[model samples]
Target chain A: MKTQKFLLTEQEMPRKWYNIMADMPTPMEPPLHPGTGQPCGPEDLAPIFPMNLIEQEVSTDRWIDIPEEILDRYAIWRPSPLFRARNLEKALDTPARIYFKNEGVSPAGSHKPNTALAQAYYNKVAGTKKITTETGAGQWGSSLAMCCAFFGIECKVFMVKISYNQKPYRRLMMETWGANCTASPSTETKAGRSILEKNPDSPGSLGMAISEAVEEAVSDENTKYALGSVLNHVMIHQSIIGLEAQKQMEMAGDYPDVIIGSAGGGSNFAGLAFPFARDKINGKEIDIIAVEPTSCPTMTRGPFAYDFGDTVQMTPLLPMHTLGHNFVPAPIHAGGLRYHGMSPIVSQLILDNIIRPEAIHQLETFKAGLTFARSEGYISAPECNHAVAMTIREALKAKEEGKEKVILFNWSGHGLVDMASYASYFKGELADHDLPQEQIDAALKDLETLPKPRQGGK
Target chain B: MSTFSTAPPSDDVQVRCPRLGHQVHFGYCRAENLGSPCFKALDCWYLQFDVVGYFKQTLSGADFAAAFVHQGRPKMQTLVDLIQQAKQGTPEEPSGPGKGSA
Candidate 1:
């Protein structure tokens, strides 16, 4: 019988996360302070994050040790299987050997828990009694909730009001994990109150939820805030995915020639690709692709520029990042890849030519999801579909080339919680939407007036 | 905000909101953020119809600029802004149920 899945014992799990900070061909520009316009120091972030994590955020170390307690907790789902997609290869009838690291087996049903658990543990040791975070689709919220339960820390999730109502099951999952989930703009904090005062019926947004969560964390001394992705520390924590993949690939007696993962805020892709990226940086021939929705196009279309972190232009300008200035938001079901900007680390890597970015349409991703489900019998999350879609594209390309290529991708999560998207796809309800060229041109004209970031500023 | 109704031709046209991750109507996207069209409305709805043209025809230049061109901040900036705002908390204490988590 063919060995379908590559397994690693708990003892084989990578103990230290591979940090890409020490490696970059060029050091990344530091995040600046909004008010001071100087590189933001630990004190600025200290208000919301623990000092330990803040240290991790700015650390240049190539390797960071995973705490034993965190490892003990990870034992529940650590060493996730690396599967050889024999069925998918057969279905495609391609010469490419396809493989996927299944991150869906985690308690939260996604790779999000990789960072969530680490954040929760750090917060717990930092004497934080509670952690506050905002979630759009409840993936991060539920993951944090479960980790907080494991760490005995109170988890308060300010979920976007629309998703809070639309995804009640996700909210229930948070509640079941002993986390308190509230509909954002729900009159809980001043931020929520201000929005409610303006529009009583306002279906809240992720921005509104972040405002509320940050407010709650600030008002309490014992509370700290957590962000699921797009931060350096989050990337550091997520490298475990790639580190483990490396060991499992060795066990399978094969190395991937191509590595793919979907990039929303770029953490999960960085999770699976950064360690492999080290190899690519050191003269190894590997194609690392970060797949994003065509609508968002943070890396694929947007030019490298300094842009304000928020729409309000309050945050300091982030350098070497693609401003999602011309977002055409094609209303794809891949909700996670919709973040306005790519992570600074991921952005810098792109600038240095260490990573490649690709964008695909909504229909292509959904179609690839269906093909994967039919072949592998595992329905993937809408976000995961982007990677699968890109993987299939590469496989077909290899077939046409008549080259025996090895491909690996991160199966970031399962789509069980996101069946509504599938229902929409099956019912032919999903449609493409894009911005008019005139509108994009008009918007870009105004963006010129904004402050440009200093190249590699101190 | 002018009362010129920026309603879509058909209220039935719907698309999944990238931000919210669910189906929302053209009506909802147009007036998503307290009477203003979502900043991403033009970006999200142009393919369905002449969304940019419709808004250009219906809205004042100021309103139009506010909606699409001046879309809100990125997620990180919002957190930084909130921390500053929370530090300068207004006198009013939050009147709500206690913290919800265990």
Candidate 2:
């Protein structure tokens, strides 16, 4: 195969930044800024968003109703399509029926907008003028920017510097939608200032960006903070994705034997799997797998404990599978999945053994991404490559077993912005790293020090 | 698609620029990468995402009347400057009176 380079020029933004926001319920406990030790409220987030959105962030039970007005706005991309990948099965020479929920059809080119729109809508309803957030690979930032634009809310994004430098087009998409995008650790925030004072050339991390964004939101009165993944409300908003997928599968007259999604902050995976989990709880026999990067294996390796979501304690301590808050993942192309912690809901499900977890190296994941791109004609994000790897492995297993297993997965986002990583991989330049057991053990020890939740209580 | 009449606005103030020497912007600053002069002194926070595009556009456009104009060497320097400025606030521009400046 001929090698291709996907480079962006000056005038074009990635197409993923044109999605709309939908209505979602508010979270119970909003994250607080670590430096100020103050809870981020609706007022702090107003500059970037409308006041109506601020009120929605705190509406706990608002998920019960799907407002007609909101539905009208979301009808453009609300119910994404699910496909049965018969061609993949034919290529693998397996009797297994394969399926995938295509999130790339959405304007943000990922399932992220399913929840971004909801968060933005809720924040706008609450009267917030702006929304502050952090992004690793720029999907979340682009998604939020699209949503904020639709709602006439201002968006301020603190993007991880590595991704900010690597994927300039992603940032452009945010800016095209009128978002004020900054690379973290920005001098605008104290956390950013402290990190810079320590290392003049520190490559910013997602945790650091989260700390900066949280600080900005908590300190301001007109802006309320918004997070893309890993909160009950976020997961709840994302549930719409799975709900729509279930209906699509039913329409196709197919039932999946296994479901797979990649785990980052866990919103996309949860959005694809949670509705299915509801069925499993009621005696549905389905296997669900959450894939993670072996470099930062929060599920297969990290310990289950209470840890601050951000490096600075600007966020609440949630009981989840975490590789210490201070853990800075090695620079990997799959920036979105390099988070040090998994979503609390995903952590709880893994603890209960209701879902399975697997980790793969970057090389293997990228190879799977290449194969899928050749067959499906859509280059998936490196983070979503984890899910593709697991799906391919499961399909191979079915081929060996000569069983007709039904496998389904979520193709989370397109990798047009990640062509550089693919260019490196095809040239056999991709390198993999294994965190030393000693470092893993030390992170585990830190996990032990966190306060445990009371028995049977969250 | 609008053609440049004279020069585009110079909102190219980065948090840190080697030429500017501070985190904040005061007046007409060259973009960290393209040297395309901007009238707005404050760092164009949006440029972080559009650097490649901006460089390509500036190099291709007829706006040679702008501030900085180099091919590739200063592009990386501009990125480095942006990173540095991002970490350290611009000394020239004040951190807008704690909200309500707009």
Give the alpha carbon lDDT tens digit for every residue of A388-422 in model 1: 99999999999999989999999999989888888
Q: Which stretches of candidate 1 lie over 4 Å from their true place?
A: A308-316, A323-329, A433-458, B1-9, B69-72, B90-102
Off by over 4 Å in 2: A1-63, A159-166, A182-216, A307-317, A323-332, A434-451, A454-458, B1-102
Predicted candidate 2 versus true structure: per-residue lDDT over B24-81, tens digit per residue: 2312234221133431221122212333245446555454312221211111111222
| Fnat per model, in the order shown | 0.32, 0.00
Cα lDDT of candidate 1 equals 0.80
- For TM-score, the strongest prediction is 1
Candidate 1: deviation at residue A279, Å? 0.9
| Per-residue accuracy of model 2 over A1-458 as CA lDDT, tens digit each | 32121212212211121101121111122334333445555544443334544444444442444445445556666556676666666667778878888888778778778777877777777777888887755777898899989889999998867567766888899999899999877898877887777665655554456656656665566776676655455666677667676766666667878999998777788878877876765578999999987755678876665565432333344455666554423323464564445665577677656678998887889988877877767788777899988999999999899988988788888877656556667766455656557756765675566665432223
Q: For each candidate, what's the DockQ?
A: 0.26, 0.02
Query: What TM-score quantifies how close candidate 1 is to the native fold?
Result: 0.91
> iRMS of every model, one decimal?
7.8, 17.2
